[model samples]
Target: MNNNVYDCAIIGGGVGGLTLAIQLAGAGRTVILFEKEQYPFHKVCGEYVSMESYDFLERVGMPLSAMDIPIINEVKISSVNGNSFTRKLDLGGFGISRYTLDSTLADIAKNKGVTLLQETKVTGILFEKNLFLISAAQDIYQAKIAIGAYGKRSVVDKIINQRRVKHVSSEKNYVAIKYHVKVELPPNRIELHNFDNGYCGISKVDGGNYCLCYLTKSKNLRDNNNDIKKMEQNVLMKNPFLKKYFTEAVFLYEQPLTISQITFNKRSAVEDHILMLGDSAGSIVPLCGNGMSMAMHASLKAFQLIEQYLDENISRQNLEVLYHNKWNSLFSKRIKTNEYIQYLFGRKLLTNTVIAILKRVPFVTDILINNTHGSKF
Candidate 1:
């Protein structure tokens, strides 16, 4: 037995990775977390968290309720042609930036005694003789279990599971852009404005700023000579609502943050014998507005299974199988449903028609929207 081996090693420092680290360390387990970037960094995220995770976060040392966060209870969605309608959200969410949330979670995890390694990019992982070796930068760490909490895309995906990392140009990839700005939007409302082959979500986060983020097909950027400003001016601004917001809002950044080569393809729950969490396990469409909550919920599930495995109540194989089954049962259906919805709204005509139908049958809005979210976990 290696004297320096940790009970668990986590890659990436996003919601799932951080929360899982906090839980594991809080339970008196030796845990090590690797983060490629430093804390308080911006990410290309929608920045809206569903209410399902509010209590769970408060339970895990995040004082979200005490913070003056924006409570979003209403939603406004507009079509490509700017035809729109507002509806009440049955299980509404709140808004907070990844910059704030991740950093806060990191602080909590540290206070709970988790060894967090920042600015350390993991190079590889190898499972040998039931022990895992994690190679990050120039250091190698040993652990009984490893977790892939890295989000969206990573080279580790290829290093550990070559089959899962497909060429970006070969797949139906998407690009997401995010910015924080001063905008005059209702504090209790979130808006989804649609354009050709894409949608943008805007909501007020803490610190008196709004998170303006959008996702679109990769081809949209290529078609515009790979210029984000050109794509925004020609394609996104075509929507009257988008145009008004773009023109009226005070842009806070010289350049927006971006992430590319994003795919919603089904990812395995356990990759190369390491538990996968958050977007690393599976990704839902951004328009669903539940990815943040889902990631946090997954950490809760992973923590439970990992605890049993560490306590020797469950064998490693059984632990893997149970986590896989639980992950599928909790999120597979919702991911597929959101995929279908994304496909329908990706087209201009269908998006307009769907908005019209929802307006006419306003009651169905609650059902359809609520289907994308799960109850309090």
Candidate 2:
């Protein structure tokens, strides 16, 4: 509210930003958080979190066990030709909607004394003279440090002059679609069904509903004349598993949530004296279905680094270098490997062959899936 300089200022109220805010506030630090949207809203996401983050979320004040949501431990995957395989997940996961999760975290932070600014967007962040000058709706505030947790894309990236991820002419962009439905899928299983140029994942979230989300190249929609239903029939229904759900499921939303230009390119951990967290830093290809856990994990690392920075225990350069190194150590190889995996899925011959191989040697499939996910944190 006032122009008093804060110890830390966070942009975006997603999991990463909210986790950092909760940690800082709980530590008795003066923190201010800015969010462009109100709580209890939906976003285009897979809506499943890896088991790695289950304990940490409980520590952050979410009553996961008490929520009585789905605990998913089995995986079922199908290829475009309808060939499918099922396996037991190495580490199980749970599902919850962002609408409920984000709002709950916001409440926890507010109770912890975090100065949360709702429906307020951070327009630009400028670092000058060892301080961050933040601009939001004609108001400029100051903070010792700024965290960029803004999801997927934001004008703040351009203001910081960060390089955009380069996509080739043929495969330059992708689109994501999400919807909650009343499907007859099992509560303990997560499914990934492949179709032409895309894949769909289904899992149960709270309220006894299922999250049916998919990612596909932009060209698929364009080829279908920008009609989602047409694209589904022509491209996705090729997989019998997906066809069944699309036709038989009870759609809960009038219109599906969609986001375009989703890119999984390399980005810096720290930029312009600001630490980038979550999707703002780098995104894991969604086919693996663990992006939520990665974002929450990165937030924990960011909070630790910020504490060292504010306490003067580490030099500014050291803080930047440590966070950068830590991020790469934990996620660099995983992102690169998933990028290749995404490319592999886009090819028909390769995907079918891979599925055949996975069916023959089920242990190999477990190894591949484990590579994309992290251990319990």
Candidate 3:
């Protein structure tokens, strides 16, 4: 096999990786990106990009308005007990299906001169004196900088022996199932309905369809014979609000896409020669409702450090240290905050109380939203 070399090689062509490739290529660096999957594939994601991601999307030369998806301006939270609170979202977020968003970003990366290797799965990384070798299933490539934008799980993480926390029993070990459904829900609103053991969210996506998804502890579904339909009917339908939607809503896609056994524990940013980004670095609780923005934001941080090192403005050791420090400084507090909020949401009573308080002092809701989701970038 031919050994091709580039200034930077990115594993995983997810949002973070694609964004970084575009940014780096735009800045006059040669970047090659590998993705195991082809474009327009659906992943189990909320498909909502907060207002914070608008600027980044524009900077990357992707048109948000061109997508023709809904723009949501309000967030509504409801309890299983029927107490509800409505907060005008501090900053409106955009909704586009991952099928569209991912393809759009990939197109932008290609247009910006990023070498994209589709259907390529990276098998391992080899570290050496001045360059790192990246081995894919079929070929090998080398680069001065290697980025782990691989999203969630990859062989690079294991090769580096990155830190891992012992799994602890928690209510957060839930399954998320998302569906594209045809519904008459408001185009500018996102709804969150709480149930006995979990919560479900419904919002408009691009292409005039709604994304209905839920997260529930695995045990709840297991007790129901691991039947998703049965669990939705028995447990989810128990919520009055969800019952109305599920009964009336028409599923647009064939079947729901699911991600099982999701964990939100801490992870190190720098591992071996690869710098982790997006969910691979660390994920915030889904309740925060802004992981999309976080992933895009991480690409910006990764690009800054990478640009400096590639330009010989900093030493490799210092770049790794600085990347880790910056990653922790900017995101550690937010992750911890989300963890605390997740605990509160895990308990039904705390969630009700928090919603009540937010309803009483509406501004508190805005503050909470701003804190949970950083200012628009």
Clashes of each: 0, 0, 0
Every model's Cα RMSD, please? 1.4, 1.4, 1.7
Which residue pairs show collisions in model 2? none
Candidate 2 local lDDT, residue 77: 86
Between candidates 1 and 3, name the one with more favorable TM-score: 1
Query: Can you tell me which runs of candidate 3 are displaced by over 4 Å?
Result: 163-171
Model 3: worst 10 consecutive residues (lDDT sum)? 159-168
lDDT of 1 by residue, 199-244 (tens): 9999999898999999999889999999999999999999999999
What would the per-residue lDDT of candidate 2 be over residues 114-208, giving only the tens digit for each residue? Answer: 99999898887888889899999779889998999998788788788655445546484888999999999989999998887889999999999
Alpha-carbon shift of residue 101 in model 3 (angstroms): 0.4
Model 2 poorest 10 in a row by lDDT: 161-170
Model 3, 243-292: lDDT tens per residue? 98989989876778998877776787888857888888888877777887
Candidate 3: lDDT of 140?
Answer: 78
Considering lDDT, where higher is better, how would the candidates rank from best to worst?
Answer: 1, 2, 3
Task: Please give the CA lDDT of all the candidate structures.
Answer: 0.91, 0.89, 0.82
Give candidate 1's root-mean-square deviation (CA, Å): 1.4
Assess the local accuracy of residue 371 in candidate 3 as a C-alpha lDDT between 0 and 100.
76
